[model samples]
Target: MAKKELKKVFNLNSYEWWRNHRRVVTFGLFLSIFAFYLGNPFHKEGKVKDTCAKLNSSFQITGDEAMKKLNLKEIKNYNNRELANYYCERYLGIK
Candidate 1:
């Protein structure tokens, strides 16, 4: 059989189907990888709190003070770790 005929036999719509399902496919892959990493005990939550505490002591500034210094607004959807890390890495001149 010709190559075109062989490809038709193997469902040539596979590429088109993948193109249409990109978002679902990407989310599924991210979830699977996230689940694998979330299984680790060393990766427990509240770790950022401890890190933040260390950051506070090391920089001589509490989280609240750091937030105020950085001018992070009081939003319900805030990322303290990101803000604190930014201060640590950027403002405090810590490596």
Candidate 2:
């Protein structure tokens, strides 16, 4: 007897499914990754504040002021270390 081909269980492999749920899929993936990183064992929540505070003292500004200077495309999208890196790298012109 010949074996029949198995059908797909879901439409996830279909282009139309992706087209219909592009935003949803993208958002869910983003949230999942964000949550994963948030739960990381060595993640520090105040590195940005500490780094900014230290960097700011050199410029005679406050930590809040340094963060205020950050030109984030979406401020809410970043965590502390990411914000610090971006701010120091881009805003403060640090390497």
Candidate 3:
């Protein structure tokens, strides 16, 4: 009687596959995470508004003056919370 021969089609336990593809797979996952972060940073809703409001209440400077200080033409292009944070960091020296 002749014995039938079988070939190994899939190597589930092969670490070589992961070793060879590690960089590519890692980069792809990293790119996906970055894309998700860029699309939705998960900042609280109206955080900019809230920060700006607090700044406005605490500081005597008007919004336009703040814009000028920020070297911006207008507030439309900047995020209020980030701007306020930078402002506080510079003026208040708070970490």
Candidate 4:
């Protein structure tokens, strides 16, 4: 009986299996997306703030000054403050 069931399961087509389990697949996909959104590193403002504080304490400089002093690459789309925040976050591995 077990061998017969195993054969039947193994013989099932991939498309037919997917069609039968569409609700489970959709739920799993939704869960994966929700987890990704909740755990996204780039959205952590507290980390950036903490990194900026650490940079300020260690270097006595603002993010803009640190960007120039470290010779970090400039991103044209971001303003000076945003660029500084990004630099601080990246340089310190906060992101």
| Highest-scoring model, lDDT | 4
Worst 10 residues of 1 by lDDT: 41-50
Candidates ranked, most accurate by lDDT first: 4, 1, 3, 2
TM-score for all models, in order of appearance = 0.38, 0.31, 0.33, 0.39
lDDT tens per residue, model 2, 1-95: 12222325433357877889999999999999999887764344355445566654555554345455543343575654456556666644577
Instruction: Write down the lDDT of every candidate, Cα atoms only.
Output: 0.65, 0.58, 0.60, 0.70
Q: What value does the lDDT take at residue 5 in candidate 4?
A: 87
Q: Model 1 over residues 46-80: C-alpha lDDT tens digits?
A: 44445555756656556566566555665466666
Ranking by TM-score: 4, 1, 3, 2
**How many residue-pair clashes does candidate 1 contain?**
0
Q: Cα lDDT for residue 60, model 1?
A: 56
Any runs in candidate 1 off by more than 4 Å, and if so which?
Answer: 42-95
How do the residues 1-95 of candidate 3 rate in per-residue lDDT, one tens digit apiece? Answer: 12222223444455887999999999999999998787663453244444445566766565555555545444567775466557655654566
Question: Candidate 4 lDDT, tens digit per residue, 1-95?
Answer: 98778868897446888889999999999999999898877656655556577565755666676566555677787665567766776767875
TM-score of 4: 0.39
- After TM-score superposition, what is the CA distance of residue 52 in candidate 2 from its true location, in Å? 32
Scored against the true structure, residue 21 in model 2 reaches a CA lDDT of: 96
Q: Model 1, 59: alpha-carbon shift in Å?
A: 50
Native-to-model Cα distance after best TM-score fit, residue 28 in candidate 4, in Å: 1.3
- Best by the TM-score measure: 4
